[model samples]
Target: MTETHEIGMVYLAASDLELADAADDVRGLPVVTQLGHRLGEVEDLIIDPVERRARLLSVVSGGILGLGVTERLVPVEAITRVDDRVHVDRPEPAGDGDGRHRGDPADLAEEGYQPELVDRPPFAEVYERYGVMPFWTAGYVVPYFLRR
Candidate 1:
């Protein structure tokens, strides 16, 4: 089942749904920027239940034993290739002193939070960073890779 957010979009954690094709599953795959900088590994997908496609990649990085880990959401449009690793078209953000990017922490969702509770600001930043049109916009097409 999908939950609709205040933004009027229906999103669900892919972990809660089964994929029609197991081979297309991207969870657990490492994510890299265009320069091959390791960003993190995909922990789950934020999928649009109404569209039946993935919208965002929930990537987890920088933590030991799950402590202090950061989760960032990347719009699917940022994905350039998907094979051994998920390659994004953007470059890594410059780091802050703490080894995390400045402003990056603002993108994080609360742990165990429902997808329907996701806010818009972080998603806006993600789409801007990736230069991808938001799915809600007219003329936005589901990326070919995510169609399956």
Candidate 2:
């Protein structure tokens, strides 16, 4: 049996838990911006145990042999579609083409920085960055794509 450990909101990695359907697993899929920019790959799913659904996607990018990889939590509501790649409706960073807009989660990860995942503060920041409602907030709903 998979063991789940709860923190503040009880977010756990989907890799350590059970997926309702194996085919629905998107752990290895590439995450792309709406403009077709490659952000990263889905490292894991952060699920809310109370809701029994995915709330965030642990996206990993920019690392050599897993040494300097950066992981960022993305709200599942940011996902626009899912096929071979997980497409997100995220805006491109506005800058001098360095792709480093201040406070942007994708840009932050590209800079090889991993955000803290076990806290509500970071979770709130991610949800705000993605312009999505937090799972803990009122009127927040899981995306239809993840409903299965």
Candidate 3:
């Protein structure tokens, strides 16, 4: 549960990854479990420039007509593979009893930051002011999705 504020990138311009250097285009790709279950579509990637690797992926979960869509942060470490789709081991059931989804801020750090994820009230206040919850508080575990 460590937390760091390293700058990252969110590629929302395309539905696929289009790096010139052979990097996998994960945008719009469906994230699935090893057992073959649709989780959700990758909306964006959080890249750590210093580490020269992707730190996290922004996955878009349930929503209707572009409304009530929740964004979840998936640590790169959790991703087991990225072939035709991003593969990840199943996550444990979320049971904090807070009635909200949450992730660890520590996972957001690229490296060198692994203390503990601290709650920043300022961020919470900002989210409250904007009528939006922080990504971490939204949900930590990825939810299942049915492919169309």
Supply candidate 3's per-residue lDDT for 143.
27
Clashing pairs in model 1? Answer: none
Q: Which is the better candidate, 2 or 3, if ranked by TM-score?
A: 2
Residue 79 of model 2: what lDDT? Answer: 84
Residues 1-148, candidate 3: write the lDDT tens digits: 1123433333323213333323644778888866887767786655434433444556666755444544555555456677778886655224322112333444433354222223322333433332333444546343221011
Query: Which candidate has the highest TM-score of all?
Result: 1
How far is 143's C-alpha from truth in model 3 (Å)? 22
The TM-score of candidate 3 is 0.50
Between prediction 1 and prediction 3, the one with superior lDDT is 1
TM-score of 2: 0.68
Candidate 1's C-alpha runs over 4 A off are 1-16, 20-24, 93-122
Global lDDT for candidate 3?
Answer: 0.47
Q: What is the lDDT of residue 21 in candidate 3?
A: 27
Please write out the lDDT profile of model 1 over residues 81-138, one tens digit for every residue: 8989999887754332112221223334445643333343445556766678988889
